[model samples]
Target: AQSVAQPEDQVNVAEGNPLTVKCTYSVSGNPYLFWYVQYPNRGLQFLLKYITGDNLVKGSYGFEAEFNKSQTSFHLKKPSALVSDSALYFCAVSQRGTNAGKSTFGDGTTLTVKP
Candidate 1:
């Protein structure tokens, strides 16, 4: 089974500060990892993904994540955060080439960027 974990229910960061959102995964085979952000009452928006290349993958809105196969982790990062960056973030995982349309999502982590 493929699954994702976001240990923290919420993350608080100040504007202009860097932020990190932790994530971990479990899969039977090579994993397709993804990060998505959700605004209030809205659907998820794709942030970034780690499929093949460099373990360090950059994504939308100045966000990035490192795919660590040995650790089974894909932790999201941002060099600097904005108040607008506050949102619900999710870490998702699916087996490579296995109809990723049905990827499993972690319990979302709410990011609060205080101005």
Candidate 2:
């Protein structure tokens, strides 16, 4: 079965410091990995994706992720955390089954950035 795991319920960091939100997945064949950020009452915005090639992928708002195929991990990282960056983050895997539209989301991780 295809699945994802996000062990942290929340991650706290100071503004201007580097931050990371961890994620891990399990899938048959090659999987499409993604990271999304959700603001309060707002739909998730796509941060990045691992489709093919290059382990390192960059995305909107200075966010980036490294797809570790060997470890089955795709962790989101930012060089500097912003107070505005504090929000709910979800790591997802695309399931190309009949539910291709389905993106299995991790139980979101709330990021709190202290000013």
Which prediction has the highest TM-score against the true structure? 1
Over all chains combined, what TM-score does candidate 1 have? Answer: 0.96
Off by over 4 Å in 1: none
Q: 1-78, model 1: which lDDT tens digit per residue?
A: 778999999999999999999999999988999999999999999999998989999999999999999999999999
Error of 1 at 58 (Å): 0.7
lDDT (10s digit) by residue, model 2, range 1-115: 7889998999999999999999999888788999999999999998999989999999999999999989999999999999999999999997555375677889989999999
RMSD of each: 0.8, 1.3
User: Where is model 2 poorest over a 10-residue stretch in terms of lDDT?
Assistant: 94-103
lDDT of each: 0.95, 0.92
Instruction: Predict model 1's lDDT versus the native.
Output: 0.95
